[model samples]
Target chain A: MHIPDGYLGPTTCGIFYVAMLPLWVTAAKIVKKTLRAKQVPMLAIGAAFSFVIMMFNVPIPGGTTGHAVGGALVGILLGPWAGCIAITVALVVQALLFGDGGITAIGANCFNMAFVLPFAGYYIYKAISYNASIDAKRRVIAAGIAGYLALNLAAGLTGFEFGIQPFLHKTASGQALYCPYGLNVALPAMLGEHLLVFGWVEAIVTALVIKYLQKQSPEFLEEGRKN
Target chain B: MSKGNNFIEYSIAGALSFLKESIFADEYATKEGFLQSLDPRIKVITFLLFISAILFTKSITISLCLYAICLALAYFSNVNMWFFLKRTWIFIPIFSLFIAIPAIFNIFTPGEVLFTLKLLGLKLIITQQGLFTAVLFVTRVIASVSFAVLLSITTKHFALLKVLRIFGIPQVFVMTLGMCYRYIYLFLEVVENTYLAIKSRVGTRLHYKKGQQIIAWNISSLWHRSYYLNEAVYNAMLSRGYTGEPALLNDFRVKSKDWVWLFFTTVFFVILLYLNRK
Candidate 1:
């Protein structure tokens, strides 16, 4: 789901950077007000948790293992605002220190994973799990559904971003200067794989984690539950 | 862990060290190399400038030239040529192969036909324009990735974190990021130990359902540990006179050499931009 450096034009990257600025600021502000001064350590640990969460390889069927983005899981655990900041920090670390994601595309990658995934997942889970007790099975189901849709939604946006590159930036001879795939190809390619494979991985992991937390420590789920 | 075909296998060591090999090794950053001598802020800014020039230019020649300069920078920075090559090449093929190769065929970008090949009794036309587009996309990726990787390897991670101030990232977030960077390794060790215990206890063959249960247990326990640690860390910080506001030390200074390097990079950037417009 991480867009590499060359796939998107400078304009697209610039636009995302601008677009994410307000979201990030808003997220930080809300997180501070919500968590108070304690937000610092909470967010830092959350960031580390989210970062290492990606390293936990879950065994799937057919003898293969997959890692979850854990964006949705974090959002459900820490609330969307805090989750967004934590995931953003993790992503920044990944891009800058690890070079997993593109440096120029940090804004774009964070927008997809940090903002879109968390907000989408948190809200979807909240909407579905409304009024359910912390220990309810409905909360676990909600988490799974949220994970699947959140990942798909983020993948869709990424595909759209990549698809527009040819139209936005191309040579006079119609050669694509950046990502060459049009919306037709990019959208289906991104959405297809996620819908089939990764979305399920995310869903099972998110659901399993929620189920465990519901049993082990239901207070973790209570933060995002408050009206 | 399993040698069997259907056993649930997780390469914990490989997955955990995936980032550590690059971040923690710091083999090149410690060396008294050319790039290591410069301020990290200057190096990062210069790398960003080079990347911007690469992105702006539509010319494959310009991109490749910048890519060459990136390699030279890495060489001067004391990064091993083979190691650097492996890093760049590994990422590029997995990424560009999917996105770039498709662009080379006539289906994506129809243009003057360069050649045609029969594949499975079907004619596939390769176009000059298509080839140019693909190569341009790839070289842009290579140039940008090389420079980004170059900056990452030559500078210490903490210095790079402090350099985030230049980009206007909040001190708190920077502090958080630094903490996150530090704790990630700690958790990595925990994860390593946990996996090792699991392997020792369960051996190679485990059912997929059991594996899933183990992962859930692992994640939840991790959350519990991090939760307790966060609270303890906060109290520790309070006892040590840490306020809500964080103060990160800036030990970087723009020396004469940094200025000289900046001047040359600016000149190269301008020339590249001019060439890009043509």
Candidate 2:
């Protein structure tokens, strides 16, 4: 799911960076105003959690293993703003430290995982879980649905980014300069993997985590509400 | 059920080995080497410049040459050659090849047919233009990833975060990054121990459903523990007079050698850009 560099042309990368700059600024402002000094540690720990959560290999049904991106879970636990900031930090570290994602494509990666996934997931979770009792099973169901949908939405945006490359950037001879596949190929390839596999993993992880938190640390869920 | 147990066992092994390799890389960063001797701030800027230059060029030759430069840099930096090659090529290039595979068929990018094959009463043609396009995409990705990996392996993680702070990145963002980097390894150990404990307790052939629940339960417990840990850490910071700003004692000064390195990189980038445009 991490888009490496050279997959998207410079034009696409630049556009995403431009689009994300203001969003990042707004996120920083929101975090500054709402995140208290004590909560600052929570934000840092949340980022750390997102970073290492991928290392936990969850066993799926077909004798295979998968991991959740944890973006939606972060958004549901921390508010969207804090989630955005936390995941952005994780993404940047992955790019710079592990080269898991592209350095130039940091903005694009963050736009999808940080901004789009968290905000969309957070709202979906809020809308579904709204007015439910704190311990309602509906809350867990809402988290599952939100996570599943958020991952698919992010995957769709990523597919569009890859799919548009050939159309928007090509040589005079009509050869693709960057990603060679148009939307017809890129969209299905990205969405298929997520919809069939990773999305469900995310949903299960989110729902189960929410359930456990409800039993153990319900206050963690309430933190996002205060924000 | 037995197969599921094998899958869990193999994945745990895979995850552990991968973590071990990264820990090795972390130790390598502190070793004396060519790239390590350079100022991290300068390294970050020059790497960004090189990456930008790579992105602007459409020529395969220039991209290959840039990739070669990265290999040479890695060699001079004393990074194990096999390790460097494995790190760079194993993930990005292979993944890009899969993405680029469909592009090589005539159905995606139509051009002069290089080869034709008959399968299932349907013709599959590999176009000359399509092959070139795929190679171009893969080479560009390889070059970019190599430089990124080079930067990472050659610099200490904390020093790299400090460099970001020196380059005008927001203090809070840098602090968060620093904290994240520090805590990730610790948490990885916690996770490893948790998995080990689970593995030890289980007799064999753990049900997939049970495995998922256990993993989820561990994650939730980790988060719950982090709540108290965060408060404890913040209080520790308060005792140390941390006022939302982390202080680093390592002062960075631009020595003459750094200037020379910067000048060389700038000239090299200009030359590459010129050749790329031509």
Candidate 3:
């Protein structure tokens, strides 16, 4: 599902990179301001968590194996910013050193998996928590939903981006060349398949991790609590 | 150690050049007519729409045609086309597998043979539909992969996240991405140092047992280290007047250049769509 370069029209890739630039800059600034000497170990652990967890490649019941994105897990343990940065670095290294993703495609892959998923999941968790009426159990549920949905949303974005090229064709024959709604074809099917088959894993993993983080060290999210 | 360092020599140069280009490239230049300066939000939306358009397509001929146009677009960007092609290579193996499976399945399944052979009482038949479906899948996959690459390489990360946030993406997720971007370098620096240290210790013997164990230990230790680091970081934030409301950059205005780019792309897509129908 990770896009390689050249498969998409250049316009699409160029635009995506353009879009990514600002976010990258902002993230850099934030890290510079917030990352102190003490956080180095946590950042390292988050990176290690990302790498080790991904290495396991959770078994999807249909006989295909898909690894945990671990976006929310990292977000829960380390602040989302740390989680996102750690994952992004991990992906970049994986692509460059291991040849896992295309070098050209790194921006898109990073944008989708590293940038989009963790951020989306984090806020979703936050939004749910902010409501005074919500109990811890609800917050946990919200966290679960946010984490699961964020992963799928990232997958959905990939599908949507991939879906863009085919819309250019007009004829029935041309129509044959592309999928009309990338969302329907890729997202729902992929998300649906996961929902029916793998959603539980996503939810469970997310819930358990969030629970542990909250219980073990409530202070980890202390900064986030004020927000 | 030498071998490891040597392996990365080629890539390090490429990375350096890209960094140079990113650092030095003139922000004002419009190499590709006008698409370069579009607001990140508009670009993000447009990119998403473009991807959806491609996904809607299923025909090989259309996919090929669309791919041709994208190639031309890349040329306009003036980024090295070779670099672009190299990036797309990652998808070939995966797509090849995708194409091969259905063809192989067709041969094994007991279907009316469009083409058939009998070997030792086992039938090997390829159905026309199976072959067509496989080809169709390949073209679609190829088209999608290329499209994704096209969007990512040219954009920066910051702009994309802003768009995400503006589009009502949760702050937690947005902050997560921002922090991730901020500190990725910190991790990389650590990894690079670790690699160097490991190389110094295990010069070339590449002792299979020790090397393997070291790799495993690295993974575990890395986790422990990062965990402690997070605790320390949180405490630091507390001392430094850190509240939950993330400090954000001032909002950007969508310049006229951005509108022009958006208009042009929209028009171009509309035209391509019209032509495809014709």
Candidate 4:
């Protein structure tokens, strides 16, 4: 899911960077107003939490293990705004130090996983769980569904971004200047993998974590309940 | 070390190995070498110029030449050639080749037929434009990644994050990034120790249901611990007269040689641009 360098045209990457600017600013403002001096350590620990979350290998039905994005879980656990910043920090580390993702694609990758994934998952859980108690099974169900849908949505947008590269940047004779796969190939390939395999992984992880935290660390869930 | 039959050991080893890998990579930064001596801010800017030159050029020859420059820069920086190659080549550029494989066929790209192969009772045509496009894509990816990897290896990670100020990033965000880097190691240790405790009690190859339970326990316990750490850590800083604004150490001093090298890189970039036009 990490888009490497050279897969996106400069224009596309630039647009994503421009688009993410205001969102980052707004998130920072909201977090500062809410957490005050606590935002630094809070967001830092949250970011580290999300970073290590990806290292966990959970067993799925098929005997093979997979890791969860944990974006939605973070959103649900630490409100969406802080979650965005947390995940953004993690993505930056992954891009710069680990090279799990491309430096140029940081903006695009954060927009998808950090922004869209968390907010979509958070709001969907909110709407579905609607006034349910912190420990309600309904909340667990909401987290699961939110995780599935949010991941799919992000994956779909990633495909759409890759699909448009050929249309936006191509030679006169139609040779793609960036990603060669058009919508016909890119969209399904990205979505198929996520929808079939990753979505389930995300759902189970999100739901299970929510379930565990509800019993083990309800205090934190109560903090998330505030905003 | 990254893979194993036991998920517990795998996760623990993977997380701790990242810590070890990071420490190992920092060795290159500590060496007295070309990139290590330059001010990190300047190093970042010149690397950006190199990447821009690589990305903007359409020729595979030019991209490969830029990649060679990356190797040369790495050598002068005291980074081992094999380590650098393993770091860069085994990354996304290799995966980019597989992605390019499909793009080289006639079904995805239509162009001059370079050759045809019959596989599984089906005729496949490889197109010249498709092949060139694929090669160009892979070359560009490799060059860009090499430059990025070189920059990171030659500069300390914290210094790298601090240089984000060069891009006008918010001070708060930059501080948080530094903090994130700091505590990631702490939690990584906690992950290792916790897994070790679990393995001692339960051993490897737990039931899948038990694995989920343990994973859930890991996630939830980490969250609880992080929340508690946040409160304690913030208060400790406050007692030490901490405020929102940070006073950071400013140790970087630009030398004349750095300026000369910057100028040389600009000239080299202009020459590449000229040749690109040719």
TM-scores for all candidates: the values are 0.96, 0.96, 0.53, 0.96
Candidate 2 global TM-score: 0.96
Query: Which of the two candidates, 3 or 4, achieves a greater lDDT against the reference?
Result: 4
Regions of model 3 farther than 4 Å from truth: A1-227, B1-34, B91-105, B108-126, B206-209, B231-242, B260-278
Candidate with the greatest DockQ versus the true structure:
2
Model 4 CA deviation exceeding 4 Å by range: B1-5, B274-278
- In candidate 2, the residue pairs with backbone N, CA or C atoms under 3 Å apart (3 or more residues apart, or in different chains) clash, namely none
**Tens digits of lDDT, candidate 1, A17-92:** 9999999899888877778675468888889999988877777777677778888888888888899999999998
lDDT of 3 by residue, B127-184 (tens): 6545554565566555555655555555555655555677664454555555554444
- lDDT (Cα, tens digit) per residue for candidate 3, span A54-116: 543233333333445667656655566666667766675444333455445667777887778
Name model 1 segments beyond 4 Å from true.
B1-9
Q: For model 2, how does the per-residue alpha-carbon lDDT over B143-244 read when each residue is reduced to its tens digit?
A: 999999889889887888888876677878888899988787777778777777777878588777888788789889888877789989999999989997
lDDT score, candidate 1, position B37: 98
Instruction: Estimate every model's Cα lDDT from 0 to 1.
Output: 0.85, 0.87, 0.55, 0.87
DockQ of each: 0.65, 0.73, 0.10, 0.61
Off by over 4 Å in 2: B6-11, B118-122
Worst 10 residues of 3 chain A by lDDT: A173-182
- What is the lDDT for B272 in model 2? 80
> What lDDT tens digits, residue by residue, belong to model 4 across residues B139-251?
98998899888888889999999888879887778888898888889988998999889888875456666777788888888888998899898987788777878655768
